[model samples]
Target: MAKRASRRSAAEDPSWACPCGTGLPYADCCGPVHRGEGTAGTAEALMRSRFSAFAVGDTDYLLRSWHSSTRPARLRLDPGQRWIRLEIVATERGGLFDSTGTVAFRAHYREAGRPGTLDEHSRFVREDGRWVYLDAQPD
Candidate 1:
């Protein structure tokens, strides 16, 4: 059977801050992107939304935003794992005008009663006029 999209509503509390460390409320930030109501304007914004998608178990959004060449046939999120925070270390040319860019980030998570961090430098490219995740490189 195909995996069903998550049922959790993306219309989170309007006052709740977005999980992407953007300080803005979910409704004003990544929420719109996740809902398909809007598109991220830059690679960094897309990267931030992807992180938020993981945090909320939005696998559908993750797959949709991933570049087709690298996108997997299926995505599985560990129910025992909880993504806690994101720290963007750096970005290169992922602005509104760049066709390609990179973002270095550390994602902190806790799973199986242990804490860990995933450090990666991810690449993004414009696909059909939208930014999509291509792959990751060692940080």
Candidate 2:
């Protein structure tokens, strides 16, 4: 079997801001999470990290942060699709004290030079002491 590629740090530039809209440097925000040096402290944080993963093509991070029941064996990112921005719309109960939560957001992207957006309300759960993505609520 071929060895899966590990997630590389998206923070190649020390001064780049995090794609998660945290207003923090990539190294201070999602980069540590992507690098396995830390974990997201809340469901919202997990959601943000996952979005950053998509933006940076960190498939391993995406898989690790996904709940096993809903996690796929592999993830493929479209190189043609460039994630540009994220707009958080709402969050429900996915706090430090809560075991589960939901986040609604709009992810802006560009594909083949055309712009688009994906709006979703994602569910998250705390499993084995970490927040992991569960599923997206059906529209």
lDDT of 2 by residue, 67-133 (tens): 9999999999997897878999999999999999999999999999999999999999999999999
- Per-residue CA lDDT of model 1 for 14-120, tens digit only, reads 88778899999888998999999999988889989999989888999999999999999999999888787899999999889999999999999999989999999
Clashing pairs in 2: none
Residue-pair clashes, model 2: 0
Q: After superposition, how far is residue 1 of candidate 1 from its true place, in Å?
A: 34
lDDT of predicted model 2: 0.90
Q: Of the candidates shown, which would achieve the greatest lDDT relative to the real structure?
A: 2
**14, model 1: CA deviation in Å?**
2.1
Candidate 2: stretches off by over 4 Å: 1-10
